[model samples]
Target: MSSSNKPHYEADPNKVDYDEGNNRWTFKPRGLSIIWGNDRRYWNLPDQSSFAVDRTLNYDMDYDQRSEALSGPHWKGDGSSISSDKACPATCRVPAKALNIIWGNDPRFWQWIKLSEVETRSVGFDEGARLLQVNWIEVTGKLPTTMFNVASTTKYEVYYVMKFQVDAFGWHSVPIKFKVRLNGQETAKNFVLESYKEKHDVWHEICGGEFTVSKNAAGVVEFGMFEVKSEWWKGSVVLAGWSEDDVSQSQQTREETSYSQPRHIEETSTEAKLGETKLKRVEKEAESKAPSGSTRESSRF
Candidate 1:
C-alpha cells in the first residue's frame, strides 16, 4: 500500500456510484488496490474468466469470480477493504458459474449474464444464470459441512437467491421445489413462483429449508431448485445465485457482513444420477411421509 498510488489508476464508473442528482462516481481514486477486487480487477478488467470459459469463445467477458467466494475481506467502496470490516469464522456463496446448473452452459437452454453494475453491487454476485427456455429445470449447489464449526445446535439456512424476467412464463401451475439435505437427512419445500410474478425483476430469496448443523454431517450439505417432473417449457427467469448462511451472520448490516475466509468448492461437485445428464426426470415419491429425523413444513408467501 502506498500513500500516493491513487494517481496510478482511475475510478471505475460502473463500480462507483453515479448519482444523476449528485453526479457521483466521478471522485478521484483513493489508492491502488492492494489486491484483486470486485469493482476493479487485477487491472481495469470487468471480471476474470476461467480457462474453460475463455476457450468457449462466446462469453462477453469472463465470469466475475470475485463476487462468489473469496479468501479475504470484501470491499466497501471500490475494492478498499476497511479495517472496520472484520472477518467472521467462515462462510459460503455459490454464484451461477459455481453451481451445478443443468444445461447452464448451453446456449439454447440457459444464458449466463454478467451482472450489471447495479446487480453486482446490490446482489453481490458477478453473474447470473438466466433460463432461456427449458423443459427439465434443475439447478443444484452444495458445500462441505466442514466449513462450519462442529456445532449441531447452530441454526443455518440455504436460499436460492433469484428473480424473474418480465416475460417469464410457464410457471403458473407447476411447482418448483427447493430442497436441502444434510447428515443424510433432508427437507423439501415447494413454491409456485408464478405467485410472485407480479413483482418481476425483484430478487426473492426462496428459502430451501432451515436446519441445524449436525454432528453427523460430513460430506456436503446438498441444496437446489428443481422442477424436473414436468414436461412444461419454462423461460425468462434469472438464477442469480445461492449460499449457505449462518442465521446470525446474515443479520448483520451489509457493511458489517461477517464473511471470513471464503473457499470455492467444485462448481459441479454434486454428482448427477444415471438418467439426469441427458435429461433429469424426477419420479413422484411413493411415500408421502418424510424420512426419519427430517421435518416437513408448508411454504408460505
Candidate 2:
C-alpha cells in the first residue's frame, strides 16, 4: 500500500498489549504493524518534531550577487570592515576583475571576521594558488545564535565543519600554525602548514565533534585563528548544524511571539493594579463623605 494509504494507528502507551506469538505489541487499530522484540524493535515513532538548521558564511566575492559588488579584495583598519582607508581602483578589464583582488587592510573585503582587536594586513595574490595573503588576523567572537530554538530539559547536539587553507606566502620556509576554538574551547590541536612547498595551497578541514547545547539556551560557536608568523593564509570558512528538536520557521515566529507574552501580561497586570488602587482611593473618599455609618447603610438600602 502507498504510504499515504497505509493504515496508521495511535497506540496508547499505557494500554499496549504484548503478543507472545509474534513477540510484538498490538495496538487499537487492527493490522497495525509495530514490532518490539529481540529481533526487531521500533521506538519513538516519527512525529515530525525535529528541526534542522544549516548556515554558512560567504567570504568569496565571486558569488556575491549584490549590485554594489560588496564582496572582493578589500581592506580595513582597526578590525572594523565597515569603512575602508583605501580601495583598489575599479577596473573594467575581464582579466583584472577575475583576479578578485582583496586587500587585508580593507575591512570591506573580509566579511567573515566579525570581531578583531589586533592590527592585520593583506598582501599579494597567488595566481596559481588562488589564495590571498593575510597576516595577524586575530579573530574571536560568537557565531549567530538567533536561529537556535532549544527546549528546557532536552539536550541538543550541534555539529560544525570549517574548511580553509593556510600557507606561508613564500616569505619564509618555516611552518605556519593556525588555531581554531569553538564555544571558547579548543576544538583540535594546532597544526602547522609548511611554507613554500609544492602543496603550500593544501586545504584543511576542522571537524568539530557534536557539542551538547543546554536546554533553553542558544548554541554558542566561536572561531579563533592566531597570527601567521611567516606567510599569508587564505581560504573560506563554513559552519553548519542542526538540532534534534527542530523548529519550523513558522514555529520559530510563534516562539518569539510567546516570549513577548509575559511582558504583555506584566503590562496588563500593572494597569489592573492601578485600577484597583484608584477604586480603593475612591471608596475611602466616599466613606469619609458619608453622613454616618447608619445613614450610609440606609442610603445603600
Candidate 3:
C-alpha cells in the first residue's frame, strides 16, 4: 500500500491531530473533566473537547443566569431612582455596670454554665450559630458569679434575656412554656415563647422578669425552660443576664485585696457568705440607733 493511500484511522476518539510525515494517527482520549465552583451547581468542563461536550448540560449557564438574577435590584420598579433612608439611631444606652453573658455560641465566653437535658448544636449557614436544644423535659443552668456581687442589706435585681427556636419539622398542639428560676425559686411566671409551634425554624428572643436577690443569699441563681406537654419538641436556648447596680464598696474592697494581696483575703469562705456576716453587723447598728418606745395608759387620761 502507498504511504499516502495507507488507512489513516484513529483508534482513540479524543485525538484531533494526524501525523502525515510518519503516517501514524495520534490516539489521545478526549477527557470530560469538570471544574466545580464553591456551589456545586456552578461548574465547567475544563478538559472537554467539541466531541465530548454534552448539549443537554446547562450547569454553567444556569449558574450564571441565577447569579445575574440575584444581582438585580432587590425591590421592583425604578430601583435606581429609589432613595435609601438613614437607619434610626439607638435611643437607649447600655449601663456601664451592666453584665452580659452569651453562652454556648461564643467559645470565648463561659462554658461551665450547664445546660441540663439539652444538647449544643450548630445552626445557620456554615454552622455560624450555636444553639442548645432541649432533648428531655427541661433545660437548666446556673448564673455566673461575674454577673453580680452579693451585698449586705442591699437588694440586687437580676434580669435574663434568652433566645429560643423550634425545629422546622417539629410541631406541638400547645405552645412551649418557659419557667425561669433564680436559686431554685421561680422568679418569672411560666409563659409561652413565640417560636413555639412555628412551621419553619426561626429564632425569637424572650426577656424574663426581674428576680430580686436578698442580701443573705449565697447559692447561684438557676434558669430553666420546659415544654407544657410531653412531646418530641426541640428548641435552642441562648442566655444573658445583668445586675441592677454596680459592685458595692465592700465587694470592691474584697476584690482589690484578692488581686493585690491574696494573703489578706480569707479562702475559707466565699465572698457571698462574707457579705451575709456584714449584713448582720449592719442590722445590729440599725437596731442600736432606734429609740425605745413604751406603751402607757397615762396618755388616755
Candidate 4:
C-alpha cells in the first residue's frame, strides 16, 4: 500500500496483445501486478516434470486459499476480492487427458417453466405439494472447444453464466453449469453439467478438481461429471469421449454405471385387486353388448 514502493515483476509476454496492422502492442497485466514491498519473492519455477502431466495430476492454481489467507492478515489486491484472472495461474501445465472447462445449460423452463402446485393422486395417499421443476435443457459448445495455442493463447478463458429466476416476491437461487471437455479432443469430446453455487445469487465457476476422464487399454475412453442438483431434483447426465477402435467395452461399462429408475412392485392389495377385477368385468360387459360384425367399427373408434 505504499505509493513509493515500486512494484517489481517480470512482464509476461502472453499478457501483451500485438496488433500487426497497427504495429502496436497492448499489455494487459493480471490486475495491478504490484509486488509486496517486503523484497522476499516466493515464485515457484515451472520445470519439465510440471509439464509432464499424467492422468492423476492437474494444475489449477486458483488463488482461492491464497486469497482467503491473505484476506484476514494482509488485504492483497487492495482488498478488492479474488478474481478469476487474478486467482488462476498465468500458466498451467496440465495433463493431456485432463478435460478443460467448456459449456453449460440452465433452462428456465427445463421441465416446467411456470411454477405450480398439484395434489397427490395415489390410492391411499392424500396430500398437496408445491415445487419448482425443470423440464427442458439447451446447451451450446464452440469457443471452449477451440484449440489452445501455446504462443498466442491466453492462460484462462471464462465461459460461465448464472441463470436465476424471481418468485415469492424475491429472487431465487441461480443455476450454474460448466462446459468441460478433453484437452486434445476438444470438439469431439466434451460434456456439460451443473456447477457449484458460491452464494445465493452467484454460482462459482467449475474448478479443475471436478473434471475427470480416463482412457482404457483398447484406446476407448470414459468421461463424465457429477450430477447437478438443479430445479429438477433429479441429477443430470452427460457423456463424451468415444472412439471406434475399441470393442464396445467403454459403452458397456458406461451403461452399467448409468442411473436407472427404481422398479415399482405390485403389492397384494385386496381392495385394489377387486377394483381392477370390477373394471375388467365392466369392459367385458361393454364388449359383449357390441355386435359381432361391429368389431371393426368399434376398433376404428
lDDT of each: 0.54, 0.28, 0.31, 0.25
Model 4 segments beyond 4 Å from truth? Answer: 1-133, 136-138, 144-149, 152-159, 163-179, 183-198, 208-301
- Model 2 residue 110 CA deviation (Å) reads 7.6
Could you give the candidate ranking by lDDT, starting with the highest? 1, 3, 2, 4
Model 4 reaches what TM-score against the true structure? Answer: 0.20
Residue-level lDDT of model 4, residues 1-301, one tens digit each, is 2233444545445445566876765543321243552222322122213421111211232344333232222101111221233222222212111222111211211221211122111111121111123221223222121222223322232222222222211112222222334453331112222122112222112221122223221121122222122222322221111111111232353244322211111222343345345434544554576445332111100
Candidates 1 and 4 compared by lDDT, better number: 1
Which TM-score value belongs to model 3? 0.29
State the weakest 10-residue window (summed lDDT) of model 3.
Answer: 87-96
Quote the lDDT for 152 in model 3: 42
Using lDDT, give the best candidate's number.
Answer: 1
Kindly state the number of residue pairs that clash in model 4: 9
Off by over 4 Å in 1: 1-91, 150-152, 214-217, 249-301
TM agreement with the true structure for every prediction: 0.54, 0.26, 0.29, 0.20
Model 1, residue 61: displacement in angstroms?
39
How big is the positional error of residue 287 in model 1, measured in Å on the Cα after superposition? 15
Query: lDDT of candidate 4 vs native?
Result: 0.25
